[model samples]
Target: MRKSFQKIAKKYALLKQGWSPQQNLFYGFLTYIIIGCILLCLPVSQKISAPILDHLFIATSAVSTTGLVTISIFDTYNGFGQFIIMILIQLGGIGYLTFTTFMLLSTTRKMTLWHKKILSTEFTLPNTIKIKDFLKSVILFTLIMEAIGSILFFIAFKNEGMPTLEAVWSSIFHSVSTFCTAGFSLFNNSFMDYVDNNFINFIISMLAICGSLGFIVITDFGLMIKNKSHELSFTSKIVIYGFLILLTFGTAFFYFLEPSIVNLNDSRFLASFFQCMSAMTTVGFNSVNFGVFSQAMMLVCIFLMYIGASPSGTAGGIKITTLTAVFAIMKSRLRGRSNITFLGRRIPYERLYIATSSFIFYSSIIAIGTFLITLTHNFKFEDILFEVASALGTVGISTGITGDLTTFGKLVIIILMFIGRLGVLTFGLAIWSKTITENERKVLKEDIAV
Candidate 1:
């Protein structure tokens, strides 16, 4: 057994050497999800007997940090299974590569050339920050933030008369879940029961915001504070400002458009703010029932979900940086500028290409997913569209249709969730490996009609 294990490991290591960093991440996530599914299929892992596919669905959803599930997590999984899921969420959210890097760094601060190359591509880290410092910051920041969030949640649950053990467990589980933007809840209705729960809502929203703001932005913010820098990095500025702008826009729009849906008895501001932040951050928690929302507001939620979260973070999306770049490029083109400049800095052509390409890839996947799902299920266009968007965004806010999906539909959602967790671009590269040598060797250029 040991020989076989060692042999497999050796082959895997050899094969991985030829893979791009993106492919490494792709397989890493896939391998993790498969292992999670196998564990979740164990007799002890589940409270009751369920089909193997259901277990796979739960495992995939947990590993993807996506809350889309056919089973009620609260009822389907035993404490052991729930704990496993929680661990998977945390690992998935922080990324498996990150843990690998930390392990490598613990014994030796120095990273090899190959290690640095993979880390650079995986996290999109700036050259200015050492790999060791970046890994440390990612770990320390996640722990510290999750710890603070847990304390607050524990107090809130204790106040609600939940037992000490359960409260503590719930607090820790939810703090990590919320901060990681996993949104897997022990509650049946997600956060709907806590619509008016001030303490829980506030803490959760804050955690989701911090988590989805992207780790790069968080690290940069820390640097700014430590050095008292006069300004943020261009990427950080775009993320922070764009996030706030989106938050405000979502809140105000939801407040006005869905005034009829808001529970007036509770704090309307809290309801509005919480759902807005939740959707924007791709955190599936919702203080209000989205199904009850007006069509206009539901569409608004879809749009917010589509925009999703920032880059290099727990949350998934086309990313704020990409969208910011796209908008900047449009502005530049309209003004007849020769070069794309943002915040007094010139944007490289490669950067603009990535932004545009990512945008295209996101749209393509969403469209393809929606089309494929419609073939298997007879659902409203809006519901089908919403499901696709939710899966592709890695945002688990469903139109209450996820539970009724057929086997084919479930399979579709699973694929979307997997690709969504790994960016569309990364998926493309993994399936269709590209070579710089080939591109440079071919000098052919063609223009497509605009």
Candidate 2:
């Protein structure tokens, strides 16, 4: 068995040699989803029979770390099935290349050039950060944070009179789910029962935030603590500040402007902040039913989801950094300034180009996805838009229309979730990008109207 496994591994390694990093990542995630779907289809994995499409959807959702579900996970799947999901969540959260690189580093004590290229493709790290440190930190921090969250979750669940064994399992599952920002809750209502429970609310929120903040910020802080002379990088600063501003603005908007949340008898602020955080972090855990949300509030949530937490994190979307660049470009163009700048720092043209491309491409995906869904499903305009944004953002909190989605709608969302998880830019490159030889490359200068 061991020799056979080694032979298969060798064959797979040979196959990967010719593939680009994007292709590797794209196919790696696809492989995980396929395996997960197959496992979920087994008789032992189901509590009751379900459509193969629903199982495929759940597998995609879990593997992408997007929480949109066409069926009740708790009612449909048994313990073993849930375990498979948790594993998928962890894999998606940490990323496809993380474990592979980590194992290579452990056994060989060095990364192959191909491995470095793949890591760089997966994570856009600053020049100052080393891949070795980043990989180690990603693994170490994920384990540490998830561990702490599990302990607290266990305590909270036990205090609420959950059975010992159940609490233990729930704690582990919720901890991984929240930390990964997968938001695949065992509960039917998704934390609605614990709206007023501060301990649960706080723990879940922090876990998601930590995940969404991106490893750049986390690793920056870690380095800062270890070496006092080290300063936080510009990228880290932008991600941190952008996340804070969105969180504060979203929370206040929900509390003051959303009637249903403002009308809550108590813990109104908590509910507002948690919902906002869920969207911003792309965690998808909701303390409130989005069905009661006004159109205006839904719009606000859509905006939050549109510019998700940060890059190189478990969370997905165009990302805060891209949003910042787009804003800077707008600000500069409005003032007729020749160069774009944000927060007193001039943005490089290369970075600005990538950011602008990402902004345009991301927006296009959402628009196209929404338009496609509209053709098939008879749902509210805002609800359809929200669903598209959520799927594209991989922020799975929805307005209770997921199960009712037509088969076509479900397929659209599944595609969006897959694209979102790989990232709009990554997926686009995988499908349309190609290497251009210098000898064949040509530069054409042209000007176009704005």
- What are the Cα lDDT values of the candidates? 0.84, 0.93
* Model 2 / residue 289 / CA error / Å: 0.7
Cα distance off (Å), candidate 1, residue 357 = 0.5
What is the Cα-based lDDT of residue 217 in candidate 1? 80
Model 2, 101-207: lDDT tens digits are 88888898989898888889989888778989889889999999999999999999999999999999999999999999998999999999999999999999999
Q: RMSD of each candidate?
A: 1.8, 1.5
TM-score of each: 0.96, 0.97
Model 2 regions more than 4 Å off: 1-11, 437-440
How many steric overlaps does candidate 1 have?
Answer: 0
Residue 250 C-alpha lDDT in model 2: 96
Residue 228, model 1: Cα distance from true site in angstroms: 3.4
